[model samples]
Target: MKQPLRLHTPRLILRDFQREDSEAVLAYQSKPAYLEHYERPAPTREEARAFVDMLCRWAEEQPRAKYQLAITLDGGQVMGTCGVRKAAPGDTVAEYGCELDPACWKHGYALEASRHLLTWSFETLGVRKLFALTRPQNLSAIRLAEALGFHRVEDGRYELTCP
Candidate 1:
């Protein structure tokens, strides 16, 4: 995608990550619940800053292969992050992922944001196939992916193909 990219849902706005989002990203990522499904360590302040910077840099690339955006609630509050990323530029296949704050869980924000992300991927990004890898224990993510029409093609991996 390109700069100023934004996707809207009934209750959320998936917009490009700004430099000011670093603090909110850091705040949620520092919580234990954020890393419950993943084995990676919690992000330090510097790591969070670097991540935001990377997202911003990716937005500016000439042939961008990634679209990781901050999930905000109706133009306010950074609730989480969502992305649809091609494995390589010009590839028709891509993978998607989303991370919502623990507090935002159960509100269906992830599902809403993810559906919008996939639509943009298929229609705007020309992605013909999309997949997601979620930890088995993360049932919420599994359900969200399924709701978006992805089926389990292998252990911990789900996929959907555009019609």
Candidate 2:
């Protein structure tokens, strides 16, 4: 699906990641707690640069298989990254994920960002279903998914269908 250059909400501006966003991304990613959640080891500084480059490249592609946005405030402070992607070819179910800076946790930003994302995926992308996978112990993610109208589909997996 083609993505707009940016999306706005009452309190957030979702935009493509900028070159300057690397520092903020790196800062949050450096947190040991956050790093543990990723499948791979924590990125080195050089690797982080490459990762950001990949994010920007994906954001620039039209009809992309995946799109990620840098979640920011209206004032332009970077919060984290949130995105949706085709789970598999012609699967009808897209995968969603979000990460918020530790400093910005508990502010409801993840939910707000997710609401916009799900709307865009369902309406703009013509998606009918969305899903998320998280560690079973991640209560906050589970709550956020439930708050956004997802139901437990399986162990550590949740699904949300369009209304």
Candidate 3:
């Protein structure tokens, strides 16, 4: 969908990541234990730049199945990242995920961005099914998935079916 890929919620904007955002991404991804559930975090400027490059490449792909929108406040201060992307090789289904700055957690940004991502995936991208995988210990992700109507398909796996 070559439409500039901007999604707006009541208080957030999901937009493409830019080169200059590497600094913010690095900071957020390195905020101590904010990334405990995920991998080691984007430990360095180089890693952050790599992530931005990945996002740019995905944004440039035709059919644009991957979306790594920077979750930002209404005024454009990025606070997180969330979107759907190809789940795996040979898998037509997409995977939904999000990571919010701990400082901004519990303000419902994850929930808002996730709902918008799911809606855009189904309504615009014609995605029929989506899945979210999180560690069983990641209570927030599990709760968000369930609150957004994603069903527990198995341990640590949630699936959302779109009509």
Candidate 3 clash pair list: none
lDDT of 3 by residue, 1-163 (tens): 4666788999889998877788888888888757778766447899889988899878877756688899989846678899888854334588888898888999998999988888988887777788889899888889999999999989999998895
- Provide the lDDT at 133 for model 2: 93
The candidate that wins on TM-score is: 1
lDDT of 1 at 54: 96
TM-score for candidate 2: 0.88
lDDT ranking, high to low:
1, 3, 2
> In model 1, which runs have C-alpha deviations exceeding 4 angstroms?
1-3
CA lDDT of each prediction against the hidden true structure: 0.89, 0.83, 0.84
- For model 2, name the residue pairs that clash: none
Model 2, span 1-163: residue lDDT tens: 4544688889999888877788888888888777666667767888778878898877766546676888999847788989888854345678888998878889999999989988988887777888899888888889999999999989999999999
TM-score for each candidate, following the candidate numbering: 0.94, 0.88, 0.90
Candidate 1 residues 54-144, lDDT tens each?
Answer: 9998787778899998999989979899998886779999888999899899988988898888887889999999889999999888988
Candidate with the larger lDDT of 1 and 3: 1
